[model samples]
Target: MGAEEVLTVISNVGIWRLLKAVGRSRQRLGLDAQRRRLVRSIVAHEERRRVDSEAHP
Candidate 1:
């Protein structure tokens, strides 16, 4: 899933519960990898946008 999907799931389920589940599952959920995926997706998305927009404001 992409970052938006991950964020939607987290928002629906609650971050604390997700954290507890991750903790109890010995991290087999690969949350870190998912996080890395999210970060990369966000960076890639941002890179595709117009960088000049930020400079004018």
Candidate 2:
């Protein structure tokens, strides 16, 4: 399977829960900026990939 398919499977397996866990860990470690940046980067990258895939396909 492709990277996109793998990502979809991860999402199906409660990625939000995983994100929340990360957020909690970040809070505990006082890494708010790092966590926010990580989340933003992930979102932007995913959006770009989705748009590119749609445009190409």
The TM-scores, one per candidate, come to 0.41, 0.48
- lDDT per residue for candidate 2 within 1-57, as digits (tens), equals 999999898887787777777687776566778788899999999999999999999
lDDT of 1 at 49: 71
Candidate 1 wrongly placed segments (more than 4 Å)? 1-29, 51-57
Model 2 error, position 30 (Å)? 5.2
Worst 10 residues of 2 by lDDT: 25-34
Q: How far off is residue 39 in model 1, in Å? A: 0.2
lDDT tens digits by residue: candidate 1, 8-49:
987977976877776866565576778899999999888767
Give the alpha-carbon lDDT of every model: 0.79, 0.86
The TM-score, computed over Cα atoms with residue i paired to residue i, of candidate 2 is 0.48
The TM-score that candidate 1 achieves is 0.41
Residue runs of model 2 more than 4 Å from their true location after superposition: 1-30
Displacement of the residue 17 alpha carbon in candidate 1, Å: 9.0
Clashing pairs in 2: none
Go through the candidates in order and give the clash count of each.
0, 0
Choose the strongest candidate by lDDT. 2
